[model samples]
Every structure is written in C-alpha cells, then in structure tokens.
Target: NTTPTAVADAGDATEKGGVANGSGGVVASGNVLTNDTDPDAGDTKTVTAIKFGATSGTLGSALAGTYGSLVLNASGAYSYAVNETNAAVQALRLSTNTLSEVFSYTMRDTAGATATANLTVTIHGANDAPVLAVQTTTQNATVGSAFSFVVPTTTFTDVDSGETLAYAATAADGTALPAWLSFNATTRTFSGTPTAGGTYGVKVTATDLGGLAANETFNIAVSVPGNTTPTAVADAGDATEKGGVANGSGGAVASGNVLTNDTDPDSGDTKTVTAVVFGATSGTLGSALAGTYGSLVLNASGAYSYAVNETNAAVQALRLSTNTLSEVFSYTMRDTAGATATANLTVTIHGANDAP
Candidate 1:
C-alpha cells in the first residue's frame, strides 16, 4: 500500500507520499518515523512528526501502518493527522509532565485534530498600606505667639489588607516639640504646642504593618520682637531758662522781687513794670527833719497807689526848717503789692536845713 504521512515545518504541515510492500505497511510514530518502502528489496522511508490542533498532541495508532501497532504518548509526543473525511473536527489538549507539551504549538489542521497549550500564571499582592499625610497650620510662627494645627484622625489603610498605620514627628531643627501637643493612638490625632520660634524644618514619618514608611517635611519661620519708643516727662527742677541757667536770678527771678521780673514756668515769657511806690510817711523838726515810711496804701478795690501827707504839724515843721541846724531821718517803704504783684519805688523830700 502507498500512503501519505503528515510532516510539520515550523507551524505548517504537509503530507509526503509513503511507499509500502504488498505484505508490509509504513507506520509513523513518536516525533520521527522509520519504515520499509519495499519488503523484498529492503528499501526504507522516514517521516518527520507534524503539529496539529491549538497546541501539540500525540498521534494514536488507530490509523494502522506497516509497523506493528505503534504507541503514542498521551503527553504530547507526536504530530496530529488530518481528518480525510470529516463530519466534525476535534482538538487535543496538551497535558503536563512532557517536553513536547512544554513547546508551544499552533493549529495547522482544524478538521483533523486540535490541541490546547498550558500556561504558567502569577499574581502580585496589593501595595503596602497607604501612609497618612502630615498636616500643619503654618510654616512660620512668632516666638511667644501660639499656633494651632491638627493631625488627621484617620489612620492609613492598606489596599490589600486594610490595617491602621502609626506615625511620629521629628524636629529637624535640633529641638524637641513642646508637650502641650497631644497625641491619640486610637484616633491617630496629633496636637502639639510649639513654644520656641525659628526656622524649624520638621519631618513627619508614617509606618504601616508591612514595614513600609513615608515622610513629609515642613518649614517654620519665627519673627523677633517689635520696636517701642521710650516716654519722657519734663521735671520742674530739671528745666532751665532759655540761657541754660537754673532757677535763680541769673536763671529764674524771685517770684516777688520788684527789682526783677518773673518768667513763665515753661515758656519763660517775662511779666514787667516800671518803678513805683505805694505808701505814706510823717516828719517833725526845728530844722530840717525826715521820717521813716509805712506800709503801702491800697484802695478799696485793692489796687495800689503812692500816697504822702504834709498836713500834719510834724510834716509842716519839717518844711519850715531853714537854719543850718538840721535833723536827718531815713525810712524803708515796705511793698504792699501783695504776693502776686511786684513793687518798685523812688523818693525825694522837699525840706531844707535852717541856719541861724
């Protein structure tokens, strides 16, 4: 008998003519085949394995040839044969534990046979738990001034297993954070007081159950104190006249000195008046005579004015004296201008000495 054996080249398969003797027939098996073309003459034929179906499959002995009952491994050992007259095509699924199955094979013949290839699979787990984000109210702050900030209460969660995470803050400025800040592990809330002010770059680190960690840093700016001017009050005794002299004659004049004018307590504006007297006097003598003066005469209105009386006998006698024989008297007029006024005076007598 003469038959055709299937051979696969790359993915395509072709049927090659096969020769046989009257009594002996050709058989294809395994990945390679050996056969006798002429039994009497000892001629031989060889066939290469063919690929079939969706993958690779074994060739069964149901299609007998000259070689006594050929055996094919179910573990994808041989190529597949085409269905000469097919009502419906069937495919073969490659199994494990075989080298032939390890090599991927595509379908070359759909009607005859089909096969399915095996594939290795892998799945990665979810990323480590998500880290909580750090929160802050301000980056810079003033010393002695208070700053308020809040840390979220929600803990980080892993996409795969969903577990709470832990966190801590590190002061990169080489100082410790104040204790006024509070922390709650259950709520994952963090609150703290920062007493010191400066450029503090702080880092907050968060860790999860899977040993994964994340960190964030923040900068703070602190300001110094503000400027303030001193207040001054002028002292009474410390104040001097426009000439830089203290409160005295060459400085401030006496409050009641008729000879000197007084000045304003602050502005130094002087209050002045001409010389004038306010008083009365009396006298008597055989020759010329003089008398001492008395207190000033003030009008009913309290205003001052000069007053002298010559109506008295003593005063008339003093005026009548003409001989060289004489009497002398002097008087001091006391100022009666009161505490608030100054008094000035000049005096002249109109009496003469008598001569015998």
Candidate 2:
C-alpha cells in the first residue's frame, strides 16, 4: 500500500466550560482519519502515535499540556481539558488571554506506511470565583459597650482582572441581620452597642460582579455588665483534737482554702481571696489573729491555719468538761471584675484527755 496522508483540524474551546470539573472540554468530535487518505486499493489508515512539539505521546491515552491535558483515540476522536488547579492555568482567569497547543499525530496504513498531521487547540480564558481566607471566627462584645469589627478585605481575593468585590452581611442561618447589630456593606464593617447579652451568629459574604461569591461565618458574644456578683459560700475547716489543759504548746491545727467554694456568676470571672481577717474586710493578709481559744493565721490565697491555745482557760475548760469549742474567721473574695463577697470559715476543736 502507498503511504497514508494524515490531516488534522484546528478546534477552539472555553476554559472550564467543557465538563463539570473543568478537567477537559471537548474541542471537536469527528473521525481523525475522515479527512486522511491512503493510496492503494481500499487501504485503511489508523492513528498510531501522537506528539506535541518534540514531546512524544501514546495513542488512546491522556497527555498533559502546559496548562491542561488532551487525549486522542485510535479512532481519531480527541478531547482537550484545562487544569483548573494549575497555577499557570489559574493565572489565565485574571485576564482575557488565550493559550494554544499544537498536537501532531501519525497514522499508519496496512503496508506500514504512515504520515503525520497537526491539530491546534485554543483555550479561551474565563472568570474565577472569589475565595475567603478566614472561614470562621468568634468575636466578643458587651452590653452597653461599643463593639466594632471590620471585615478583612485583603483576605478575600478574586483573580479576575479589574474585578471589584461587594460585601454583605446576614444571620449565620441566612436570615435577616440581628436587631442589636448593624452592618455597613460599603465599608465592610460591623458595629453596634448590644442592648442584650447573647451569642449572635453572623455570615459575611464577598461577591464579585459575576455573582461568584465567598463567605465566612462568625459569632459575637455580648455580656451583661455586673449581672452576676461574686458568691462566697461558707466553708468549714477540718476538726482539731484539743490539747491537754496543762500543755503549754500549740494544739493540733486545722487549715483549708476558704475560697474553694467561692464562685462568681460569670463563668469567665476568676474568684480570688483578696483579704482574710476576723470581723473586718481590711486586714493584713498572711497575718495571725488571736481568737477566743486559738490564733488563726490567714493568707491571701484563702488558706488559714488555726492553732488551738491549749494553755488558755477556755480551751482547758473544754477538755475538762469533754466539750467542743469552735472559732469562726471571716474572709473576703473578689472576682476579676472587682465584685467582692465575704464568707466565714468555722473550725471546731474537740476536747481530749490530758496525760500525766
């Protein structure tokens, strides 16, 4: 058979317009050998090889291009696809620039005679969607306090040239904006002095003129000032065994943290023992105070040590009568917001036998 002549046609396609995934768009579908000819009675020609410039490719397989891929079949059918994720391919979305690729293929006849032809694929650029850098966030506000947040315009980006973005706000559920908050679409700002304390969800969207959009969701927590005061619950100390009446040394001591049970209405506030004293709020912390039957030493951490004065008349009397005596000490706790509360710590002294 005589050598076969291969002929290819040029095709055009729009980037990302072919398939749902933009992987490839069909340029033109027709038999590659329909326009080819073979001299010798009824000698048929079939595609045997494909090449792009100096790079060789296999027939019936997909070949990668500078910004996309192409596949050619032995039957002469072919497809071209744009790589949407390719950085260079993405750059095309910035402008109306077009890119082209030339593919050459060889067709062989029955007698092993072959010829080559060229097919050109032109890819037209298209617009890309905007993307959000920060997807979700949480903000804070306070009742009767000024709260303001500005959307990060620089974080939202669109690759299209000369493309402008518009901002909008809605409830996180895509409803109307909350009544207590205000948003400026022009300035991309959120500002309001909330009258109530609650968690408000917001959705901010950045949209291009093409209606392609990107959005982020966030929450704003508003707190009521001084709504809940610090609570100081009365605490008890470990019981102590009374020392002998004749014993001149200190008896078994009792110690504990008086602020352990203390709390604040606000979960965020931390309660701390600001003062520990007897019958008053202003007392030297970490100082020892004399009680009826014992001396109590208290510290700023709400830890107090009470030592029974066994030699005292009242303490000695308790041992003789097999009785119990208790000493009460006062402490003051404060929250981070300066809310203070006072509570008492009671330590009981149990009478014990005196040894000879």
Top lDDT: which candidate number? 2
> Relative to the true structure, how large is the alpha-carbon lDDT of every model?
0.30, 0.71
- List runs of model 1 lying over 4 Å from the truth: 1-112, 117-122, 126-146, 152-163, 173-190, 222-356
Minimum summed lDDT over a 10-residue window in model 2 is located at 17-26
Off by over 4 Å in 2: 1-5, 13-28, 37-43, 90-97, 108-113, 125-131, 154-163, 225-356
* Index of the highest-TM-score prediction: 2
> In model 2, what lDDT does residue 13 have?
61
Q: Give the Å shift of residue 32 in candidate 1.
A: 22
Residue 29: error of model 1 in Å?
A: 30
Q: Candidate 1 vs. truth: CA RMSD?
A: 51.8
Q: Against the hidden reference, what TM-scores do the models get?
A: 0.28, 0.54
